[model samples]
Target: MEGGRWDMLEWLGPDASISVFNYLDNPADLARVGAVSKSWRKFVISNQFGKRLCMTLCPEISNFTHIQLWKRYSHQNASPSTSMDWQILERAHIAYTYFAHCFLSCDSDKDCIMTCIGASSTDRFPVESIHNTLVPTDMDHMVYWRSSYWSSAGQADPNVQESLIYHLKRGLYLVNEIRIRPFKAFFQVGDPIYSAKHVRFRMGHSKF
Candidate 1:
């Protein structure tokens, strides 16, 4: 009976429901929960879901910093998306949360030397452009690279493989998430933005 009652998520109340939701580590799980009901969807969108993910993954991501980030970017000039777009907000929160969590986790271990493994894209607009695009940066302005080759950059075409490989400088590190930002084409005067339909990452000590 207790288990059945608990399963009635609506009974959890706004506060309790949020507490329960916060326990979820997977971003996809969070998104799925919102689809369960209209109330849940509202609750998920209103709450700083991304911030919660970061806090759960790495407690060091202080509430202050997270709040400031929300205050600044949460309402700023969203180039690719509208400022009020919930999906965009969720995406930003998740990405930043991961970035912060990784940064803090790396710092936690004194012995861990967090160094950037050079990234090599299958093809770039110019040689070595990958270096500038993928480097770790502050919360504001994530670096991005646009593929120069039209053939390789086409979206939803599996035949076009735009691969990016990052070789770490020999150290054990815990990787939680990677953020990939598609160019908004904000540079050109009202050009359409292009993004990959699918993305995959592989990490292990082995030769494929």
Candidate 2:
């Protein structure tokens, strides 16, 4: 031992130490490990444990080819040719670490939907627009409340279908469960609730 100090990384070797670190799913634990010493911090950043952990939690994150850092963090004077290698690594480390932290600490129970993009078909323009579906429930009244619920255009054939698109809230890095509450038309004569028999969800970045 050098100066009677214990070095776990030295004792375990690179491969074994990496395996041990890989088992840590918690981002906070990894941050603590990096805080242990300079060597530990370098090891964590060099191997990109934060990025790996993020990819493990959300596989879709791997699809990101590049991450745009905030303008405040960017060096105004520094050009691409003049930028130091260590500076780039530092930025990457920060980005991945933040991404992992946000993913791990996210509130899964909270609603992620931000805004209604559009619907495949609406019975009426503003009256039965998809935006009305955002409301939880309608008031107990006989008259139809245009603001309370959304209605799709009636389809004669069973083969015809309708769909909805919504933009999820920003900074919602992980989506655990998506809950859809179908509106029960208490205002209608029969109190019929329109809902799909089988629901399918598609997730991806917007083309726009």
Top model by TM-score, which number?
A: 2
Stretches off by above 4 angstroms in model 2 are 1-8, 11-26, 35-42, 45-109, 138-146, 206-208
What tens-digit string does per-residue lDDT give for candidate 1 at 13-62? 67887787778776666668877776666577678675677666677655
Minimal lDDT window, size 10, model 2: 138-147
- lDDT for model 1 comes to 0.53
Model 2 pairs in collision: none
Q: Summing lDDT over every window of 10 consecutive residues in candidate 1, give the lowest-scoring window.
A: 146-155
lDDT of each: 0.53, 0.74
Top candidate on lDDT is 2
